[model samples]
Target: MTYLDKFPTATLLVIALTLGLAPFVPEPHIWEKIKMLLAGTLARPVDIFDLLFHGFPWILLALKLTRQATRPN
Candidate 1:
């Protein structure tokens, strides 16, 4: 998305590392959410929001990287 383009790669990386993978103790929150997701236990609204919240940065970063790579030089 163009919104992602507004943020520099460094910015997105920082957000991804921080917000995307927060609560690092006892493993990251995202990791737990992922496990819950796979186990079909992520039915709660809060859990869904948590997954989306922690996963946004990584998704944006991936989209940005994919776009950059596919762009014609």
Candidate 2:
């Protein structure tokens, strides 16, 4: 929405780097969740929630890019 339009790109990037790819030890949280998703092991409720939680910032960043590309307003 217009709210996201007003959201700063740098802030989104920071969020994407931080929460989107958190727990950068063994592997990024999002990366692990994605692997679980592809391996059909993401059926647990908490795993599902983890995916959504970590993916939210990236999702918003993607949505922002898509909106900017399609709607110049």
Which candidate should be chosen as best, given lDDT against the real structure? 2
CA lDDT of each prediction against the hidden true structure: 0.93, 0.95
Summed backbone clashes in each candidate are: 0, 0
Best candidate according to TM-score: 2
Find the 10 residues in a row with the least total lDDT in model 1: 1-10
The 10-residue segment with the lowest total lDDT in model 2: 64-73
5-65, model 2: which lDDT tens digit per residue?
A: 9998889989999999999998999999999999999999999999999999999999988
Error in Å for residue 9 of model 2: 0.8
Error of 1 at 24 (Å): 0.4
Clashing pairs in 1: none
Whole-model lDDT, model 1: 0.93
